[model samples]
Target: MSQREQAILVVSASTDVIDLIFDLCEQCQEASLRLLVVRNTDEVESVLEHHEISLAIVDCSTFTDVEYLNQLAAHLSPMSTMALLEEGTAEGMVAVLRNGADDVFSLAELHLHPQLFIGSLQRQLQRVRMIEEVRFLRESLERSLDELKADQHAAQQLQEKLLPPPVRELNHIDFEYVLQPSLLLSGDFVDSIAINEYQTIFYLADVSGHGASSALVTVLLKNMTYRLVRNYNRNSSFDIQSPLATLHRVNRELLLTGLGKHLTMFIGLIDERDSSLTYAVGGHHPMPVLAQGGEVAFLEGRGMPIGLFEKPVFDERRIALDPTYSITLFSDGILEVAEGDSLDEKEQVLLAACGGKNLSPQSICDFIIPAGRVNPDDVAIMTVSRV
Candidate 1:
């Protein structure tokens, strides 16, 4: 109930009971309550619906029996206290109390103890003040939550723009990817960039944590890669197309940031001229699948994760590429939902899935992500292929 609209109901057939309450209100000026005098039961119900009644003072004598008082108390609004005026026996007093009367008074003793009526009114008003304060705090909390959601949504959009398109054609090699975040922002990131004419560099990275903190690392990763490419174009560096050198440079920059974050990455350079792929692994799992000539298998390599140790070592491995082949890379999150009971069993499931689908990112996503399913962790799928 609002502070300025606290109404109190007085239900009595005689004018004496009503007069006594009015005189008590005048004597107690601290609790300013609007007095609602109603003579009958029906009038009391009407006032309760339209007014925010704080307390209801009912006269048991006006009712036919104690049953009426029982029904009235049960039907009053929640948090509204009910008091009774009954100059009857102890049996009647207990009956009225069980019927929901917070306090009972002997109407005959009012002339001797006028203070009794004043004390009860003050207590009931105190309860009303507590209710109002709780309501105000609840409303304020809801507003704060709404504002936080809005900020997260805006950050999500900017993160999406930092990466390359979902599908791209670079250096005559087709690239496609699908990234699904567990939260409003994703820790998994993917990108493909062309260097010179015959070579293309592409990578998929998974940051250590899940939400906004991990997402911030992705932004920094993209910026560092962009700076590397800019330096190469200006002839200041040649690490962009070298998988081993690129990983070392990334490790050095990530350590300098001191963001307390680490990442597992699968980075590769595809060369169409020699029909070869040179790749390096940074503590990644479910290694990229090589599908060629009706046979599919995982490539080989493992190293310490980037951004972890001061001098993390990584080795670049080369594989002979066929004229028509597809290489698929995925974040470890893919294993969480893979069809298996253990990690080894899960790896087999993924190899089987990619082998069956012939290493298509779209086909892999269809088999992995359901129409309305939310994965427990961030999932990133990327495919570098040629027909």
Candidate 2:
């Protein structure tokens, strides 16, 4: 396995030719060559079974079938270099070299000056060492990549566990959501939690960018929401019910983390007693669609994206919820998948999708994303309905 100890193979029919190769190898002790002497083709095959021959020296004059020797050399290690030793004329030597030999050595001249053969073997050993080093580095890189993929898969599983249930019902109101990531990790996130007996808070946020970095922000947002709920329960003065106040708290927390990421979000608080929906928008596009009494229209709200500025103001809008109404919220990724040439045309397609009878998150996803098609961005859908 060491670079200095190279495996060398010498094939010949005459015992004297094999001894000459072994003697030359011994003269070059600095090369540290391990010689494997094989007389016949069967012996060559046997030697190959036990050892990885790095350099093959074939005695062309002793072996009449140069083609067979060429085939045997080809079957050896890909890094193996071959040299032909011919005692005949230059024309015969050229013919043997053309068959497959990397270099040709005059057997008669080698007997007079063995140093010429020793120098050529040393060069072949250097080439073998370089090939082995490259092979080692390639294998190491492949192992590192495999380990990285395993870690990513584990992180994805943890993220999925943190997501809210696909379908949750609170106080006769049904909250349904679907989250699809372009990659293993998603930037879009959704959550619905009942603040009190009569109030339920739900939000869908699309963080700027995709993959692990954006996914990290979702975890921070979820933790912030939990902390906000605890604060509301402990202190009556803390206004977690207000959509604008909730956005403000989230914006401050996101900035404090210094992640340099912003998000477009639609946060809403539904009061079951009053039958009203109070919501705030943070630069979210293709607003939530409200469907009731055969009419469909986008909810009204607009503001800067969260985590962008220190004192950014968010607008809070309150609307009376119809007895039989469905409000569906979507991340901007829906527009990219929608069939349209422009934003306005895409908005129409979305409105048409939500215009008809009440559709669940699964149905909406099926309509927008065709079967056997992949999404280019992270998509999140949340539908809260009171029937």
User: Pick by TM-score: which candidate is best?
Assistant: 2
What is the alpha-carbon RMSD of candidate 1 to the true structure? 4.4
TM-score of each: 0.78, 0.86
Model 2 stretches with alpha carbons more than 4 Å out? 1-5, 12-40, 43-47, 60-64, 88-99, 109-127, 236-239, 370-372
**C-alpha local distance difference test of each model:** 0.82, 0.84
lDDT of 2 by residue, 203-290 (tens): 9999999888898999988888877888889885356788899899899889998899999899999998989999999989879999
Candidate 2 lDDT: 0.84
Predicted model with the maximum lDDT: 2
* Model 1 backbone overlap count: 0
Residue 170 of model 2 has an lDDT of 84
